[model samples]
Target chain A: MKEYTMVVLVKQVPDTQNLTGEAMKEDGTVNRSALPAIFNPEDLNALEMALQVREEYGGTVHVITMGPPSAVEVLKEAMYRGADRVYLLSDRKFAGSDTLATSFALKQAIQTKIPDFDIVFCGRQAIDGDTAQVGPQTAEKLDVPQLTYVESIQELGEKKIKVRKLIDNGTEIVETALPVLLTVTDTANEPRPFIAKKLLKYRKAACEFDLPKILPRYPQFKTKEELKNFLKKKGLFIEMWGLEDIKANKDDVGFAGSPTMVKKIESITLTGKGFKKIEPTDEGIAHFVAELIEDHTW
Target chain B: MASNGEVWVYAEHDWNKLQDIGIELLSKGRELADELGVKLASVIIGDKVTRHATILFEHGADKVYACEGSKLDNYDTAKYAKVLTDLTGQYKPQVVLFGASARGRDLAPRVASKLRVGLTADCTDLQIGDFKAPDGTEYKKILYQIRPAFGGNIIATIVNPNTRPQMATVREGVMPPPPSKKGKKGEIVKAIIKMQNLPNLTSILHREKTEKKVNLKASRIIVSGGYGVGSKENFAIIRNLASVLGAEVGASRAAVDAGFIEKDHQVGQTGTTVRPALYIACGISGSVQHRAGMDQSAKIVAINNDPEAPIFSIAHYGIIGDLNEVIPMLIEDIKKRRVE
Candidate 1:
């Protein structure tokens, strides 16, 4: 059996569905701090697909994400669900990156760290942005074929792979050559739960920012760097890479590289003061329907 | 630098028949081109698709670019992107718009990335406006791509001021097609598709297309449910009401996400935007995302136990009661009236 190297891209996004009143600022912009950051939903599906492929074909699944240091939480979650390795592409210079710039950063990281990868998987879109551009843009940057809205892997071979993709009205089974990128959709499959043993083992996995909290427990390791080295030896370290580490040019990594800019944001406010209250009784219901009929709203 | 160039719409078609969104965009494209004092052209890339250019001109296109070949019979992302990218680079279109359909969503980003320009996704509205950078650099007459962000908590207006050929994928049904002129005149250009260097990496094995079961955009009235509809079985009440009233069944994104209904029946920013004559929201707590799709409906009726649900605010008639009870009574009342 030939082993393949698969990379899954993931993100930690604000829980937009369960937003609190404080989710918005007085300036009518999102207060991202007020919302809890969870692993992007579809990215979990992508990870599950990668894991399933590895189980069938015997490969190592490497999960990567680019965000603030807090994003290491999703990397740890991915480890608990059977990922072999995790990388955090973190740098302050990468902030305010739109899809194109973000994809450029990811492409640089992939080429620098995992250039021999056979396949790359990504969620169709992130919940917060919902632009769904990063996956294809990254594929273009990598100079590989892209399969978007992929629902399932139909066939996999040494040189080619086939997938079922969801279209506007139907599904198409498509085959592409090796070294391709796939954007997994939510309808693909239910993500597997965390393995209890893996969870217990990786619960202490620490990135650079987490070293301080974890170092207090390991007294023999006097410094955070020492603790990080010890964790690396124990296979519990999540590697963090900056823009320079990935060989990305400073001009192409952040707001400086982004073409689109937010001109304005308006908070939606609905006013319903003119609504007529309708009773729950049959008579009121009858009268309401009659009015609807007379007004041709029926 | 390309401000005086033509505004182009990617006219997608199914087996040579132009999609409705293409015509709709041509109408909007006409207005934008007129405002910019340039031509409004459409690009249709498929085998034997020249005949569709007639409708494009009738809908207000000033010109049509038909790129035809036997290899272009079906949509191949790499091939189509290559042709469009080459055409865009050569002709220097000032603005490019796509329908934001599945194909559009897949193709637009690839072309935009190749061009190294910005492309906004799922724009609900577009306008010609001026934009100023924080550094006091002013840009005149740019495309303002308006869309809901953060799950519709706020609407953001985006601009690509420094890029040529400002590109956007506009949502279908938001921009209604203008009335067509029967004998509108336009120029037609036959574009040569150069596929020599393009990689053919993907091949379609089989395609299964089910006829679209729900046409909420064409429905006159709609009875919609939300997560508060409780269970998939309880959704029967919503369907019962729809059946009784001869209306279509619509579901909020929450309802569709909860597995209470299929995605086809979803009505919201992420789903179908509708403007039915009557929209009855049953047990739906209208988020801004939901209201973005249906607030334009002529009359709205909200039935929810919670009086504070946001659906009531935009609804013309409000019922502060349980939908499981109020809906049945309303259904029965309408049934009895039909019998009488």
Candidate 2:
């Protein structure tokens, strides 16, 4: 059996479960700090799928994320779950990226860092953008075939993989050659929880962002490079890449490359009207049915 | 500019029957064609879809491009995508619409990628408008792709001004299906794609239907329960109500997460979005996540213990009470009314 190399695309999203009115700012932008940051739900499924592939095919699973410096938290979580390597794709020039620009930057980063990977995994969509376009768009940018809504892997051959994809009514079995991209849905599999040993080992994981802040605390490390060297030597550090490192055009990486713009954002609020409040009695039930019948509710 | 001056709809169908979304797109496409002073076209790719062009014509297609071959039979993504992309390149359409069904969702992105055009998936509403860019340039006949974003907190309107044959996958049931006109005919363009040259990477071996599961998205009436249902066994009340009302059973994320029901029955942001004719929410507090899926129902009836539950705000009828007590009474009354 041949070993496979997998790249999983993950994102740190604002927790939508505990959302509140304060989560949205006056400018229609999300106040990401108003809510806790968590790993994007579907990305966990993608990571789990990648890990499953690694377990079966005997290969390494690497995770890549694009966000602010704080987004490295997801990388730590990925390491705790099971990722051989992690890379952070972040820079100021990458801000305000829509699905297109984000995919462009990610494609460049993948091409630069892991060009020989067998498979690229991504969640169907991000909870924040809800576009579901980045994965497919990124596949297009790389000129690779992509399968979306993948439910399971039926077989993994040396050159191709057989997959079952969820359609609207049924599942479609497809075989795609290696070096393909797959966008996994939540129904793919239940993501395994963190292992105790891995958690304990990776809890001290730090990237470039944490080096400057933690260097002051360590008396022995006088320079940022020295601490970084120590952490890299200990295998407790994550790799960070910027626009220049990936050779991505600045104009094609951010807002300038984005074609879709939010012309407006309208908050939806339901006004309670035209509804008859009824008590939980027989008469109330009778009136409701009578009204429904009169209005042809059936 | 390749202005074919026609609006095309991809007629998605299984081997047995045509998908309703195909006709729904034709209905919307007809309106767009009239607005743009163009013809409405349909593309069907399958083994025996040549005979189904009349069906497309009746559903408002002014022209049908039928590509029939054995390779097009089982919906190999690569082959069907190549046929559609080739046809589109040969005969360019101003705009193309596809059903946001499973096959449509998969194929649209591939064709769009090949064509290097923009595609908006799962659009709830589509409109034709003239878009004025912020740079002061004007684009005519733009496809306004409207869909819920940010977990349904807001709606975003997207326009693909630079791409030809602007593509969008309309969500099933968002647009009404036009009544078919019997014996209606249309011009047919036959392009038999040679499958020998294409890459055949995948093949289906055996297909077992994964049980006849709940069809909540396609159901006309749905009775959904939330975490307030208390226990997994307490779901009997919801099932009993659905049986009496002849409706499908649904659940919120809380109920599904609690193991009260399976994931397929979940109706929320992460679940299936539905636009049923009537929705009865029992013990549901109507969180944004839950409401995002079913707020488009024509009539909503909420039954909850708390009078201030957010579900009541969008409901057409609100009953303040315990669902266990209220549901049994409603079921009994409905049964008696049916008997009478």
Local distance difference test, per candidate? 0.90, 0.83
CAPRI class of candidate 1: medium
- In candidate 2, the residue pairs with backbone N, CA or C atoms under 3 Å apart (3 or more residues apart, or in different chains) clash, namely none
TM-score of chain B of each: 0.94, 0.93
Q: TM-scores for all candidates?
A: 0.95, 0.92
Across all candidates, what is each one's fraction of true contacts kept? 0.82, 0.46
lDDT string for model 2 (B138-166, tens) is: 87777788877666666778887777878
- The i-RMS of every model, in angstroms, reads 1.8, 2.8
lDDT of 2 at B139: 79
**Residue-level lDDT tens digits of model 2 in A45-156:** 9999999989987999989999999999999999999899999999999997866678889999999989998889999878876767778778767867788888898888
Question: For candidate 1, lDDT tens digit of each residue in A1-298?
Answer: 7799999999999988676667756654457679899999999999999999999999999999999999999999999999999999999999999999999999999999999999999999998888999999999999899999999999899989999998877889999998999999999999999999999999989888888887879989899889988899988999999989999998897999899999999877655566899999998888888898898766
Model 2 stretches with alpha carbons more than 4 Å out: A20-33, B1-4, B192-200
C-alpha positional error of residue A276 in candidate 2 after TM-score superposition, expressed in Å:
1.7
